[model samples]
Target chain A: MVERHEVRLSGSGGQGMLLAGIILAEAAILADKNAVQSQSYGPEARGGASRSEVVISNTDIDYPKVTQPEIFMALTQEAYNKYHHDLGPNALLVVDESLSLTDDLPEKSRVVRVPIIESATETLKRPIVANIVALGVLVGASSIVEHEFIEKAVLNRVPRGTEELNRRALDLGFQLAAGAVGGNK
Target chain B: MSPTVKLLQGNEACVEGALAAGVKFFAGYPITPSTEIAELLAERLPLVGGRFMQMEDEIASMAAVIGASLTGTKAMTATSGPGFSLKQENLGFAIFTEIPCVVVNVMRGGPSTGLPTSPAQGDVMQARWGTHGDHPVIAVYPASVPEAYELTIKAFNLSEKYRTPVIMLMDEVVGHMREKVELPDVPQIPIEERPRPTVSKENYLPYDNNQGDVPPLANFGDGYHFHVTGLTHDQTGFPTSAPAKAKVLYERLHRKIENNLDDILMWETKDMEDAEIGVLAYGSTARSAARAVSLAREQGIKAGLMRPITIWPFPEKLITQYASQLKSLVVAEMNLGQYVNEVERAAQGQVPIKRVLQANGELIRPDTILQAIMEVK
Candidate 1:
């Protein structure tokens, strides 16, 4: 298992990528690890590209920004084209199945095309929970954080009375990732 | 026993710290990077019977804070670069009147609204001299989210104890980042309140120096009718243009903080006991400096870091002491060069001082700092 992992989640403004980053960081803290989450977005309230980065470490974390991400997940084609080249060596590039991969992908990075948005829309029938679905997929594929802690964090953040909906969305996400990778650790 | 650990954003930690420090009033305008400080306080303050006001503008927010503080309430206002610029006039007013309030400037890139979403340390000089006149200032910068929590409490403490407006300088990175914070219990947190008048209301002198450098400040409504203004005032709290009285008031304002340097100055040193090169940094840049110092040590170059938690009255003595011992020094910050000049003055040409600066809305990376460290002969 990687002792220090940097994860970046990028999409449009309304996609909830920031909340996903927060949940991931909260999960890391719940497991007694150190984590830092930060984000950047344009001036618009929605539709503009947004990115949130989380760094998880067993030891102290210095230089809070993500320099080289070990895990990169992009839900939009614009975000994918902009950031997929900045991954670390032997890193995992997770993107939604909706995005078409370019030939110039990083040489040593592995690409996992999971149906992140589709799982939220078709399987869970709640398009807003796509960020949580993406979180499930990323954690399911990389095992950077435990599923139980992520579940607790997701439950802690979601709106009241929507816990059951988000739980199913997270579970569907895990299933999609497992199907793509043959099994989850 | 286990401590209460929660994953908190830097802004959230600041709110927690303010609430813990007996802050009863918050008046601020919503601005990027620092808006969360106001947002969280707005939601949290009312629940605790504290008042949170979304003022008309940054100036009004500052005025409201000073107004609230005069009533013996611990008040604060948070803003970014543009709003920080707007608050300067009233900030000077608070300083001139010796009102106890905290102004949190979560710094972003700028002379204007340079980068709303990015971090910069451009306000180091502004925090000291942004407001006009030759006056003493106390500004503290924290590098991490946990430190943000701890330092917010310290800001309120210093403000109340000195009866001045204390500036809490936070870069956008520290304001927006999230970290796990092990919060202390209510009983464990130390709180300080402003000293109140012991004499009768008729005999009360708001700016009495005979009592001490920081006299007992009587609240406006607490049976003490004292006058406050931006003009220079004497011990009786009335406007006085006389040179002697003006000189005495000005000197006391500076001396109150300068004389209490032992209590006001807070800093931390790492790997400095036996080092040839010293790096002086603060806020988010200090975190990068720490990594660079460690990397330099691993490369067999003796390097150390002196991070000032309090930046304003300037850590002159500490910087001078380190300058004498080290062969060279490096001043790293997000701005092109603000506090570096202060470091140079304190060093007094004792050693060569190098600078690592960036102002394009990005952090100064550790490797960039390490490269500078490698170049120092």
Candidate 2:
């Protein structure tokens, strides 16, 4: 298990990346690990740069903000361009399939591309669950927290009537990640 | 037995703390970093049979808090930098009249309307002297989410005990950060209510110091027809321009906090047994300083941390004691230089002081503080 893991999730405002970060941190806490989640965004309610960072550890967490993320997920090309440079060595970089990876990206870092938004919109028929789908993809790709804990946290956080939709979106995300990584884990 | 733990944002924990401390009324205007405190209270206060009011603006919100407290309700208001500035005049009013209330200033970058979403420690002096006059202020700052919960309760407790406005000085980082908090049972948390008059209604004096520095406060309409005013008042609570009466009132206002420093001052010292260098920090910056201290210890530097949970009343005695022992001190803060001046004053040139300052909206990283620690070492 990764003793301490830092995760960064970035997208435009209204994308619910902040909520996704909260759910991820909640999942870590449910697994009995220490976790902290923090976010930064422009004044705009939507369509501006939005980023959320979570740090999970088995020990006490100090310096709550993420400095270097070992696991990074960016849903938009703009976000990926803005934040992908600060990945830790041997970091796991997860991005939407629509974004292209640059050649100068960190050599030791592993990149996983999945159709997160597509899975939520096309498979689940709900664009709002894209954040949930992203959570699944990131967690499924990194195995940061146990899958059951993430599922529980997702159910606990999402709207009351949309549990089934979010559950499906999460499953689709895991499937997408599994397919992208050659079904290894 | 396993503790009941939950993932809570700092602002949410603050609301819980306020409720746990028996706060029954919230009056606030929505502002970033602090809006969540008001928002969560708006939802939860009514469920607990409490009152939540979003007044026309910050000034009115502060006034409303004073009004609620006058009626024997534990009241609070939350705001950011600009709003904190707007509430200062009334904050002074609350201070002068000795009204018990909590004002939460989630500090953001500012001289005026500055970075609304970014963190800063610029309000250190403001929390103490923002409200005009020579009144004593109690401002408690929390470095973590749990401390946020604990200190919010303490803020209310101190306010009620002192019959003064206590400032819960939170910054953007601690206000927005989410962490795992093992919440204690409601009945287990210590709650402090304002001291009520034991005397009969006809004999009650609002600002009477004969009983003690903090006289028992009688709630409005509690059969006690006592006057409270911003103007300097005597024991009878009437407006007085008499020099001797005003002097006694002002002296007592400061003496209440000064004499009770042992109770009001809260701080934490880590690894100071044989340390030659010390780091003094508060709020979120202290979190980084703690990590930096650990790292410095690993590198064979005898570094220690002194985190002041109670920002105002300044923790001078502790700083003086530590300064006498340490070779040098490093003060880390989100603002360029605010609390460092206080540290220098407290240290009194006994030791050299280094400041790890940042006001560009980003948190002061551990490495930056570590570098300062190295310099001091």
Candidate 3:
């Protein structure tokens, strides 16, 4: 429970990153921490780059937007390429296996390569649940929010009939991250 | 469904606040950054036995709200920049006719659809004088989601008490940003209704300037026949070309708000007890100013914040009080220089003023304001 923690979820337009950011904020609220979520997207309804930032703090948050993220999740290569440069000290960089970093690293932060999409599509048997899996990895890797709080948030937000599927997807995220290098940062 | 805490966007908060204040009718055409207000109201209004209408255009939407308000229904309309421009004539009509209604402008980058999805505070001046002629206006701006919820209720209450159209001037940042909010119980919050006629129908005058500045408005179907028009009228609501009557009636319209400045003004000040530099801001810019003030204080600089929860009838007297004490003032907004004009007029050359302005649809950052604070003496 640091004084303030900034988390960003970045991916393509249809990746549901905004909802992931929202769930994270709600989880922080469940933990009795103040949280604010802000997002931006391109004009196109799909395939365009989208990013959502969640700032969780013990005190009131004045500047809602994230200037430097302590935890950054890049669900797509373009997202990784755009946001990888700006990292807080010893930041945790979570990227899906489909994207590779061709650029130099900042040396201060740690990187976790997880198969977020592959877990959702092949293992969970539902690609649309990828965002929930990504959320699980975010919690496991950074411990920014609790798993139980996130589970409650997911159940509160997900569609009515797919609660069990999203819950399993979240568990799969934690399992995938448990085996990841430097998972428990 | 009780009054529990929930995560809501600023637009959703506006609807919640309006409903809490007893808003029964919403007439609005969907527009970007503000469509959520209409959407949420459409769903919630019907459930609460209220009516929601998606009007043909912004003009028709404004007219519809006024029409509903005349029938004693608490009504509101939400729009954005171009739509706000379209709403001005009828907004003026509401002002002169002394109809009470809430008009929300979730401002986007503007002039003409400047930026649909981006944030801007370009509507500050437009909210004050968008409609033509000399009339009274009370526009309130909220810096965050909770204030958006609270001030919308206040907007409705003010419109009812003063018998004028109240504007909830919001920006895209506040409108679109999501945050957790704890709403109060509906029964716990106070609600105001438009004052009904105290005298008999024979003695009732819709524009009765003789009794007091704000005459009691009898609802259209409340067994009282009264004429309400956009044109200047006297005791009875009829077109009048008489100079003496026009002068008295027009002055009362202005005097009603101008005379009640203390009752209408709402502002927030922080760390102003012993600060040499003051930051004056409203809307989303105030959030950044709050951060910059704390950051400057950490660096041992004397900086404080003055935020206006109510923007129009611009908090000039309070600004003047701070202007005399502070060495300089910094006005930050998303627009180039909309509200700065009033800040300067209130400062009256008593203190030097600096501006941190942006119109590129990006928010004015905290570090930018902190740098301005460091630059000034």
Candidate 4:
């Protein structure tokens, strides 16, 4: 039996952080891999720190708690500051540049800053899509989920008629994360 | 073969389990930690043509289930700490009145609204004592989503089989986390339903002795002239305060579960072959303790785990059997020494029983059990 990989997503309450986690876990489940998704949220719906964790495995995961995160994503200053310390040297850390991060980076940890918020508002015209954009970056770095599978899962989760906007958000993230956003080549 | 085992939260599996059990009636209020139970049930129960209602309060929700149960339907209700407390009086009514129903308590951290959304195994004692009196009850503590699904079906079967209430006890962790659960074909599962009365109204005795410990119940106003009362009663079902009659009724009520102890008690044991120390636990905490015992063994320590799948009726017999082999027993629970005390008493001084307890609005993890296991010396 293959081991399961753990992923943790962190952001402010209203940033659709939890939705991002759901989409990724759904992708794994859709891919026929053993997956578990769980969240820890505060009482406040907005402006509060909200977080979600997903476990992708080849075998059954005995416990849902994530003591070690193989991949971590933080979308806000508070989220980054709170979870950045928990990142081990081998962990992948994804950050949203719109939210400033002053925390000293973990030694040898891969830190990728995607303009998730700016792209969500300017390109997608919806700040809520910031999570989707970050999910693209997540899929790019982790290679744990097929990009098409994650897109389809997001479409299934979002409200009908908003699929076009969500799809565009996905395209933006995919392009940016693949180093195709600004003709970086 | 089981479906691709994608992880699902315990609450979600329960919704599917209830559907598989052929449960057709659900009425409940949303309580933190347990809300997912209602949420999932609400979504699925309707698809199966079952009735799911969010009542005004927990009291009415409990009452609604009894009313539904009277209609010859498999009725169920789910709640958390305070809601469980509120449903006690009517639950007593259920026991006295012999209403076979299922109640799921996804326990959260609590004394009273202690922690709204956090997990804790603190309600093991509550499930037993929430309703007053010496009446019989069934409590199934599931450690995983699959067990949640299978035991939920068992809860309904036992409730209908013995004509009493069955409690599906879930704590924060099991209630929320998703795990892969394999569902069996519904027809393959053994389902128990209440025996309907065949006697004519004029000759009917609701509490007839011929029915044995389990009396056949006739729906109210079904032309069966049988008396039902909360007060102490005789076999005629009429309220009687007579000492002899009350004693017989009380003994019969308790005997249904106690006398049939072997059939009612369900427990799981692991690594007990040559163990020096055993960890006794139930509910979600039991799940972690099982793994920790394996870890202890890997480190060259002899540790075993005894889990009470049936939390009530205490499973005092099994605990008594392992009395001699136990070097030091540690009881780890989500609450403060509830089931721990039962182990201590069952140990009977042949061996010492220690307690490793936590009710800090969080789940008891494996490391916590390992720590307690190391302290067992």
DockQ winner: 2
Residues B12-84, model 2: lDDT tens digits? 9899889889889999899987999989999999999999998999999999999999999999999988999
Q: What share of the true interface contacts does each candidate keep?
A: 0.82, 0.91, 0.71, 0.32
Candidate 3 chain B, poorest ten consecutive residues by summed lDDT: B184-193
- Model 4 C-alpha lDDT per residue in residues B49-152, reported as the tens digit of each score: 88999999999999999999887889999999899999999999888888889999998888797887788877778888888887777898898877888888
A22 Cα displacement, candidate 4 (Å): 2.2
lDDT of 3 at A92: 84
User: Model 4 off-target regions past 4 Å?
Assistant: A102-106, A146-152, A161-168, A180-185, B1-7, B40-47, B183-188
* Candidate 4 interface RMSD, angstroms, 1 decimal: 2.3
Better of 1 and 3 by TM-score: 3
Docking class of 2: high
Quick one: ranking by lDDT, best first?
Answer: 3, 1, 2, 4
| Regions of candidate 1 where Cα sits further than 4 Å from its true position | A182-185, B1-3
Task: Residues B66-162, candidate 3: write the lDDT tens digits.
Answer: 9999999999999999999999999999999999999999999888968999899998888888899998799999999988999999999999999
lDDT by residue (tens digit), candidate 1, B1-377: 56688888889999989988988899999998898999999999999889999999999999999999998888999999889989999999999999999999999988787888889998888898999998899999999999999999999999999999999999988998989887877725578888889999999998998988898998888888889989999888899999999999999999999999999999999999998999889999999999899889989999999999999888888887778888889989998888999999888899899999888899999999999999994
| Interface RMSD, every prediction, one decimal place | 1.1, 0.9, 0.9, 2.3
Worst 10 residues of 2 chain B by lDDT: B182-191
| Local distance difference test values of all predictions, in order | 0.89, 0.89, 0.89, 0.82
Stretches of model 3 off by over 4 angstroms after superposition: A183-185
lDDT for B319 in candidate 2 is 85
DockQ ranking, best first: 2, 3, 1, 4
TM-score of each model, in listed order: 0.96, 0.96, 0.97, 0.91
